[model samples]
Target chain A: MDSNGFRPEHRFDVELVAVTKRYGGTVAVDGVSLRIPRATYCCLLGPSGCGKTSTLRMIAGHEVISEGDVLIHDVNVTDLPPVQRGTAMMFQSYALFPHLNCLDNVAFSLKARGVPKPERHRRARDYLARVHLQDYAERLPGQLSGGQQQRVALARALITEPRILLLDEPLSALDPFLRGQVREELKRLQRELGITFIHVTHSQDEAMALADLMVIMEAGRIRQAGPPREIFERPADAFVARFIGGHNILRDGAGTIAVRADRCRLGIPEAGPHIRGRVAAVEYQGSSVRVALAVDGGPPLSVVMPDDRFFAGPVQPGEEAALTWSTRDAHALPDPA
Target chain B: MIGGGARSRDPREKRPWTFYALATLMGVFLLFLYGPMFVIYLLSFQGPNGGVTFPMVGVSTVWFEDILKPGQMANIPVAFGRSILLAAIVSTITVLVSVAAGLGFRRRFRGSGILFYLAVASLVMPSLLVGFGIGLGFQLFGWKADLFSSALAAQLTWTLPFGLFAMFAVFNRFNRAYEEAATDLGANAWQRLRWVTLPILLPGILGVAMGAFTLSYDEYARTTLVAGNRNTLPLEIYALISSSTSPTLFAIGTLTTTVSFLVIGATLAFVFRLQRRRALARHG
Candidate 1:
């Protein structure tokens, strides 16, 4: 039993067992399985059309599954409707009802369940207060800013008191500054509520920041799924290394290896087991400099160095440089089938 | 006015000659459109002795009073009642069917394209041809054509296409995210439609209602071919025109225009209030 005295059977709040979603002749989600632990933040990270959104929809019961089953808190909920599956979804557009004010939007589910007006409004106001939007209760969704609308959507989804909360690209619509703020708010909310959150996002930064379990998907399949640090340090394949950014994937004599850009040392030709290449371009990134190098028989490579170190011995564009990394820093990647 | 032939000046700083030309053209076009209606309104108040074309001897409500009396040629009150009842029925059916069809068209069914084109063809086809075809079909089926049956069908052919197209435009602007959000919030299909879809679309539905009412109210050519025994208001007015030449016809025209104005104005006022409330909600 958990500290909150929740049953052991309800430990994993959501599980997808070889779930698949097909649209006519097209396969959107191909035989994907996932397990989301209770009170954890799981992010489905992928590029557009990578089935992350489809998988999320299927879990929320918004999309019909063509094959396999979905288990929510140990219950077979594959055939259940969205409301019956004990899950609520926060849409990408923040889809707050334009006609209703913020309070009514949050209280919508309660009203649908036939909660009386006074009780529903009080509960909705409490949720509004939780999101710091109590003053804007009577205002329409359009009156609020994008970030504000997102808060209302979050509160609306939370009011349903679902075992699992699904978020579809929650931060994709926010500005960069507001995205960070809302990301922090989401983490705080999940921690407080102690409910599983399955969020879908294409942004590597967002997934890395908010996810306890970061799932990388590619072409309707999961390429890798693990903690953000483990995935970043050692991606499962070439796609995850490239998709997550800041990793240089290369074909060495042993096999494919991914080395962190910051971990590679830039020096003369005699600097250990090094690959020599001509510097194609140099980008100054405030804290560090990324030097892009072109090798004769391989793809382009990059090495990041601290700004002070780069200034000490900077290589100009079109100059020849040798790239080397510590053997321990090189993480081997599995072959893509 | 800005300087003439000053091509080298900044465009924003100077008013172009084309602006004045377009403004004058619009003014003349509006005058041409409403000039005949203005004359009809003025002549409706003509004295009892005055002719339909003409110079008024004195102003009085004698012609307006004549609209109430049942004349020997045609009864105006019963025909007016029929026109109103028919238009109300048409408006209700048009709103319901058009909304349902509009939602259906969002999902591409097998024969949706053919159905869409057929609606368009019905819209552009001559009104007289549509009425005649329906009238002929009814006759062959051994059915008696009436205002509600035959004439209503003819009007539907005209108004349904317009409502459908208008709804297409409305539903285009509608976001699917709202419906999905409703479902996520535990709303059933009926609740989602009632609370989200219909409320968002009320303004557009009102527009369709107003258009259907006006179109059916003034329609004559289509009804003429199908209206079997009784006459609608427009048909009765036509009969009056052929039977007499006096200020009474002008008065009838003026009264019909007033009714049209009152209904259209009331609908527009309600729509305006709805829009203003939405705007106010946003600002507050």
Candidate 2:
């Protein structure tokens, strides 16, 4: 299923049409619709029980459909089983078979499909090498470290060469250090494989780091969907603006303005006429120093300075700093309109 | 086949020494509870004087030869072979039907709760009643069964219930993620079952098979009633013990006991390995 990288002219073209999943009385997914680029890495970002996992499972056919169509390569596969869906999922738990060694686990689907052992092993080993776990091929899942096990899971999913790859908080099980390591590895693998990957995660940074096309969900609905940069800079609603990156959402008559703090510069500009605020709090978060200012022209605004040299030293809490941003960065999202 | 989780660094594991002593005491108690099968084995080789004397008064293969004759000697083998055949039949059917029933129960439906209760009832029912019911049911149908059918019928009484519950226990810790991952990877229902489900259930199935074999093979009362003309080994042995003490009975006892001991020992060993694997999984 490997293909050339996304030709900017081509749309990814995978669609979820009116997908509504109800669990008895509980409506888990509320008629969600999304279209992902063919080779783009799409991320579904939300809090727990926001129907992110349910949506992913629905796509995988692990959950029977209540109503909707999942069109893959333009075919409506609503009644198709998971295997027939031509998609693969990397689970949060990895779900590696304990009895099988890394090689065998990777080759399981192949064996199940009655692929010849020799060819399956060869293909499996190749996928494992891509994950840099070729050396530990014969070791069972229990023998591998958490990160290694995750890679084995990736290899197993990849060996079958499904059209789409689904990741469900795949890095959640790893320790913090291993998490960063595997995240980078997964990003690298997705890039190298040139496959469509739909990742479901609750972590904002993870979504920002890897998403080409990201969907932000709130309370079982698609709050917003776009390129990560677009969603971050121009959210469709207050929920999207707050979720993608923290935004200072200011309500107006027609819509709300979302201004990213880093884009807002604090200086002694046109005092009250522009944006005026007394600094309430200031903290250095390694690379950027965040200055929380109480803006009078609007709601209290937060300003971030990447210019570490200016705010590198101690800055008093009660200092007055006026915040400013170009009209372009301050985009308006119609409040759930 | 054991994994790292088999051994623990916990201080609690050291408490087993105390348990070991108690278990040994209990074993000695059980030995007294069931009098000398051990003594019978020892006395089997007694000389023509009907008593064991240390001076080997010319050991005779007479007892062995006596049990080896066609009418009687062939009887145990026929019965033993019949037991194996019957157990195998029952074990296979038990696994097939129970696996289906168990999967259905786990999946849940309108009547699944009642179905689950019925399954549990099958398990909780006294073996005596099950044998009696099946035997009486067979008689009402005018099915006159010889030893093989009798053993098969009796075996099903225990094996069917045993299979359903053993598999249910195995599924207690099942990960839906496996099926999810498989489905997402493009496996159909059959593929998921064969590649994912069955593999997870294998060790449990093996343990149940051995148990089913033993339960069917060692049954006395059930076999006695259902077995109209058939003299399976258990029935033959019971009649021997009831009528008079015979060296032939001890020989048969030694054979059956050895088989049962080995089966139970292997089952326990496999179960230990599985537990160890699960223990490591818990910490992980």
Candidate 3:
């Protein structure tokens, strides 16, 4: 029914049709087209200023689209406000109302819609319980810990029961340990609610761990969009290969190619391509040992080896080693446009 | 091996020469600030037949009693009431207009810079000149410069800029994310302003209102030319100073200073209570 073949029954929760965002003369999101399936977890992964947050804000209707249309549930929501478009956003800092308690923060939307106090409070309490924050209903956001504040934010965003939830760097403020816990909770909540979530983050690990559909953006354009494993196995270009860490981008006579750091061995292959370089640094990372190779006239590369395999041979810094991987393991990357 | 005989100097025990110099400067500044008011307070209690000098002729409350009686020099009670009414009007208008302008200024628009410079430019102009200009305009228009009209306008020229700058400080620290979050949560513009923005900015708004009221209450130069026939308390006090010097003038000064202190004290207490109510709850 649309250019992206979106239909009501197809149940695509969000679709961006060549959406572009501009500030003055400069473009932030340059004609990006994406379709997020219903109930899927999608991540817009890119470096800072790569337009991921701008794109997310455009989708959430916080930022106006400069060109093209945004559709939600087969409805053209380009001109609609965030509330009318059935989208709610959780800001990077959580943006909880500091003056209000957790219960009031979560009930704010319903109150805005003219819901009665008792009914909204009852609903807000249920939402708080959903986020395991029932006891924190009376506590202000400042009284809560960072993780608790994030959960309260989550409850506030979810109380609207939006068709799509937009999160902008939701875990960047939390400690590393709490990030993992919140990540798990977010995944579980998304599954339980059966709604689409489009998250923006610069961390590739967060994207790979959470996204069912991962979109890698460079500058103002989306470079690749697919499953995490698919992009990991066959990166679309050198930028994608480099942006998605744990992959070594190598140049040869044929073209640029990407091979997983784990797949590359520390010795010359019996009958395949190999490069010789000196070990620049060796880092012990508990489960794995990372060996940085400094090749002459080339970018540095790393090999992540299992700790047991690394200690068995014991390669030290400044030692010469030949890196090789089977041809089958090497995936050729496309040139940049 | 470290020797026990050598001792490390305690940082707190040492004071640089600059510290003593600055301390003396601060002490002198405070004395200069409060010394005149202290003398006025002492002289306000002079006896019935005492002069305005510092000899303190048997301290009593006679000069204070003179404040309530209408004298040939000036009507103290009427001018005092007029001063309060004018200040209330000016304070209310300053808060309304400055807050609206402050919110509008959060976004840069065409000619916004020029508008801001023009508004702030009034602060550097002589206060008497500002009133003179307004009085001239009223004369040209064949209008009477009364207490509420030209006087109120001239006083606002002094207070509005202060109110606007105070709001700039308030909004500089205000997080815009709250507005965005309100929008995302389905709050319309009016609802967002009423329920979120105003409540969050209440403390800052209260401060601006208090500052404007104080500025307007004590204003003399800006209101002098435009005050027409009737006078504010400050103008009446100035008239009494020229016509006849009495301990009653010191009583008026003491009473006004006390009123100012009470106003400032009440506002601070209210703001403190608001802050404490919204402060982070202590955890066990």
Candidate 4:
């Protein structure tokens, strides 16, 4: 949504129309349909081998679309090669060319497109400067740190000025601190460029932190696709609810319901529809304490309470406790078909 | 405890007895490998009337000078040139063919197993037998086995397998992500291969090329049966051995060794320069 009152025209940047990818007999991506809005950060979040990468590859034209079409900027690009699809992919390894220097790696696409050497170098230098890597243009990939190499990859991918950028597990190789920093940097770059950035990641925190449009996939199909807050607050199925962690899927008498750990309070059994369970484990996280419990010899349930609140009423690992959440706080998940 | 602190963590501690034993073994092995070559180098400095079997009469360049004059039966310069040309051709063909085959073998295809085994079989088979087989094939086709034709083929049979195996090892360490990244960055097949694949694998390719050149340059057995009219340096050296008992043979050996050293040294220098340039790029 823009500042103007009227809805903006040409909102959709990339559209995947019933896209299916099959590797021989096995289907990697089964008829996934999605519309990524322009200039927004979209994350395809899923576990490994769940078609998240395959979906990203198909959008980037690296994978062939078996059943349907992919459209970028309203142009059908399903059969087109990656170079002609107006999309650039940043590989998981960062894939910086070992033989090429930073400037040369960034300038490679322009050189391939037959840009003159001086002009390509000038443009490449501009992009390197944009990534604040101007001083390291002559350095080989091996000489730079992992984060620096990632920036080089980003700069190289951005040099083509594609309408959409596809990244596969963009920050999986980074350490925790660097991952956070780079994730912020990626968001900032996407905001500045005002182009669609479709990032694929397995971490729910990464997706929630970076995405305006969050897509949760399972087993080659999209379980849910919406804003991050919406998906977190209301996952469409059991798979999404479980995958997006910190949620306890409890089976009451009626049906299964997903309730966030923080929302479930430790209380006496008579207060509400309480689950009586023994404390299995207690993890003292800095901001919150996660109390793991087993209810009626069923699946384990956990409740996250603020550290100060939890210590005020600390329960030992062997003690019995009753857990209850308000009915309104519980989000019902669709039954598995 | 049986060895009592042999694996001590302290760096300043004395090394275990196994170290001395291994070092002594390595020393003896090196001596066994290079002792004969050192004697040949020393005997090459023999006097004009010196015999091939050592105890030098005097140091002279007379035998070395004899190599320049074309003999009644053998010409050292011509054979040396032929050896160089043949090795160059073999090296070039070996590198090109092996790199292509190596890239092809990266994917699993039908008959790849058969092709791989055939290469290994060619490598382990007797060199004379391979030469005889190629020579026989040429004869069966009513063709004369020459230095550039049948001899080149026989040498290739030896070097290609080495080059291919080298390439296999090289490609094994190669990451396909680089090529995928190239494709993602808008490089076509030829561009990806030329810019990404070859450059990254340059060091290994150079190693293979050097190995092929050296192998072909010094090869004798395979070329012996197939070489019909012309003689390579090794064959000429063999003929010189049968005909005369002079120190000229030692001189020829010394000269060929010198040339080999020069070629290998130049290649090492080239590869070093390439590495150094890339390294220095970081500081720059």
Candidate 5:
């Protein structure tokens, strides 16, 4: 067994023990601990200033941990440089070297390690081909489209062969249509490489689509950590329920609970918990139509209905509506700490 | 046809009165700027019997030849060599120090604000007074002031701030993600700087070098007290001006102005070539 008393089968690819980052009087990332398994796609999901990026940077060895330790492959890497930490970060902007062509950009890590020219170039070309960019070897980053640049960045990071790849909002810069395509490519890449991938993003949809383990963070702490389905079904608190969209948070005699928008029905049920409010909005989202309601004593709510179901009995914006959900669909959320 | 004619005429049919006024003002400004330089160029080619005036006595290159003879009052070639050497030194030092300072200032540290203000404060200080202070300090230390020593230090005070400010503008637009990406790709600190940072900042550094070179080449007031025994080109020209007036002075002026133009032209051509190469790759 290792010094941390973990069995061989239970060893995590990356582990953080109460890692904290403080700048002067303010704490940026306050005591975050996490464990990501081998080959798992883990996403740190949070809003701006929620320390998700800081946690990712700490794991990559880019930011120093003020309080605790960061361990990679069961080895403490808190004092090591990024190169020694076995982590590669793909930046949000892709950050490809503007002056270097695609081939040189991908070969940068090999060059840094003092590898000779022809060998590095050959290996770099192979990696580029993996990213489907072999034809654009000589093109500079500026010559490539936004999505192509991100692939080049991926190839550049992959050349290092790090055990864990840290992605900081890699798909945020792409257009919506391109974001989905790139997202699929990233997941396929992670699976094929069989390495742990830790991605940080503010988009709940992105996290839900890619993450095997979705970590919801708020104000430098993890609000909930589980599979996407688990977190979606049972958010730890009101904050997480709101941040992970399409959840209707309601408060009644039984305290706070979160119900999926798709599970919420418009007409009042014969029996079961229900909320009455004025219909605030009706939005058509191609396959699904969303109906937002303004409640008197609680936050606004929304109900997502199938387009066919919504059209059967259309509800106008100014009409009064009663939203009801089955008791099993309603999950209790703890009060915010 | 009527709609098309009206649409075409709408944009260009009328001229604003301010346009004519501004155009006339620009014309006069250009004439005022180049008027004396044109006269100096004409007078520099005056014949042996010619004077430094608009009425050319005869068309000859005698004054240009006279500039090479090393007259009793001045040694143009030696002073010119000294000026070039000093300016080169000053330019190199300014670029190196200011680029380093610019990178260091990216991160907030203790006394960073105070240090930045102190470095930039030299820009607004009177040049002569700064030279006088350096000269006085040399006297106190019993050190001899010369072109390479005290004068080099003095010129840096003038050029380094400009270099620092230029570098600030360069670094402002520079994305820190590039450096972080380099680091993540396993490059050490020095490797990241040499391969990534320096190549990206090269254009701004070149501009800083060119600026420092010209400023040092033409600097006279600051270098006056610090240049103890031997004189630089500008000081030599000043001495010649006080001693007498001749077409030879115009020759010297034209020669120096030509050198300045060549330096600026070469720098611009190099920067343009670098940009074009990048642009070509972007559109290729």
Candidate 6:
């Protein structure tokens, strides 16, 4: 907690200006700048260790700036501690205080911020009820199931009504089935509350579903930042195109062209504008079956299609197939390599 | 299922020598144990030399009664009270400080790794060494090395590391999402620490508290070195033994041993009950 720091009055949205955090000589985040709109659900989408969480932490005042300023509500709170900044963070692992029961956990911030006991309970109960965890108020975090505990955590954060809510992989811990449900619930809550939510996740699907504004990052750099449609349509670079969706990554011309599995048309070469390949393997996954193909000497490519449609008839185990995709769908990637 | 019919490696080949050796050594050690303590307990009750003599020359409770004279009897309550008070203060402080440190270190920071290593190094230092250092340091500050204050500080030094490590393990296993969720819900640092961190760390804190209390209660080396002339039970027992008093230190030993075990057992039971409740809640 730095004492000699700037404290700007609240009015502006969250902004990151030329932020740099280096782990030793290796720069985890190098000169990243971003501005999130007020009450927007923004996501820092990236691969593992891409400084998404670091950037989020810096904004939340958990991590100190190496060379930049973090402005919240338009005020420069670069050196203010998290508490004094009136910001809240949802940790990647949910770092809930395990000692408190669900209700007490929800009421923790209220109590610390000097809300009286009766009012604290009222506010906590309201948030808990919002997450549909009112009954588990007396239960400790360990006592609740993973999903239930997450709800308690959500309630805890929402009760504070901070200027901006920071979430670090908040839904990564749930079972896949529950992850979907929670993700939907989270999306719903964000819309209803309309508070600024800055979420950090490695999952592209999660970002795609939840982000109103998505910033795709890799190796501490923002490859692309835009609305979901714009990012998906015109991914600013090759990395953004490759990371945001499953890309049939391939060398095209002097640069590179990435075609999504769904976009890659699996038809005959006679149809034109298609790549000829031999079927390597087929994986059935309920709704979709991923068909792996070896394209000449190039890397193996995966083409995903609806299971019901792709397996309508017997496609030979080692047979050859023609793959085609529109040039519009083929994102131009940079030759960074 | 298809690979299940393959011939498995023989079970005997999987056995390790260390387990067998440990089991055999433990069996032999237990066999040789209880002989000396059993003899002392028997002798403490024996009439005159090993004879089962009556009141004058036989088995009697007179020695037990003699062991508790009015003066000694009064000292018992006072000494017990003091031990309890010291243990309570030391253990409580140990738990609180260690929990705070443990929670702090649980989160990653610039110098967190260095701090963790230093804490581990401190924990590894011998209790006598720490006691000597504290005692010397306190005296340098012109502070009298008393039972209450000096012993409290020394015991904290000896016990806090264990408490911290125990709590570190708790935080490591705890769900980070709960903390995150609390944070998302608007918990500030202290609020999150109080509501989420402390609740999850409760078992480890209590477990360490009980262990620290018992350790401080029976502690000898550091307590002896730093307590100056303070007369704790262990120190008192040591005095009677070296004074050629023939006092029943064995009886005191047995009582202290039982007290330690009881405290440990009670803590374990409490933790177990919490675990069971947690299990039941999950299932329900």
Each candidate's DockQ: 0.43, 0.28, 0.44, 0.39, 0.47, 0.28
Tens digit per residue, CA lDDT, model 2, B1-284: 33655866777645668788999999999999765776656556655445332443454555555567776456677777776676677777787877887788787689887866776676667767766777788888998766657557676766787788887887876777777666665566898898777877777777777767777777776667777676767876776667655465666776678887987897889877765553326124
lDDT of 5 by residue, A113-226 (tens): 999999999999999999999999998887788889889999999999988999999998888999999999999989999999999999999999999999999889988899
lDDT of 4 by residue, A1-337 (tens): 3442223466588988999999999999999999987888999999999999999988887777889989887778888888877789899988888778999999999988889999999999999999999999998886888788889999999999988999999898888999999999999989999999999999999999999999999899998999989988998888888899889998766798899989998878775667989999999999999999988868899999999999898999989898998888888877767
| Top candidate (TM-score) | 3
Which regions of candidate 4 fall more than 4 Å away from where they truly are? A1-11, A294-296, B1-27, B46-66, B69-74, B276-284
Chain A alone, TM-score for each of the models? Answer: 0.95, 0.87, 0.96, 0.96, 0.95, 0.89
Question: Candidate 4: lDDT of A202?
Answer: 93
C-alpha lDDT of candidate 3 relative to the true structure: 0.90
The DockQ value obtained for model 4 is 0.39
* Prediction 4 TM-score vs. true: 0.90
Check candidate 3 and list the clashing pairs: none
Question: What lDDT does the true structure give each of the candidates?
Answer: 0.89, 0.76, 0.90, 0.89, 0.90, 0.75
List model 1 lDDT by residue over A1-337, tens digit each. 5553435677578888998889999998999988888788999999999999999999988888999999988778899889888899999888888788999999999988989999999999999999999999998886788889899999999999988999999998888999999999899889999889999999999999999999999889998999999999988888899999998887677888899999998886563557889999999999999999899988788999999999999889988888988778889988666
Tell me each candidate's TM-score. 0.89, 0.77, 0.93, 0.90, 0.90, 0.77
lDDT of 2 by residue, A170-236 (tens): 8888788877877887788788888789999999988998889889887889988888888887788
Candidate 6 chain B, run of 10 with poorest lDDT: B48-57
Worst window of 10 by summed lDDT in candidate 2 chain A: A1-10
In every candidate, how many clashes are there? 0, 4, 0, 0, 0, 35
Q: Who wins the DockQ comparison?
A: 5
Q: Evaluate model 3 with DockQ and give the value.
A: 0.44
Candidate 6 docking classification? acceptable
At residue A315, give the lDDT of candidate 6: 67
Better of 1 and 4 by DockQ: 1
- Where model 5 places Cα greater than 4 Å from the true spot, the runs are A1-10, A268-272, B1-34, B42-50, B55-62, B69-74, B137-143, B279-284
lDDT of 5 at B11: 75
Candidate 3 Cα RMSD after full superposition onto the native fold (Å):
5.2
- Number of clashing residue pairs, candidate 4: 0
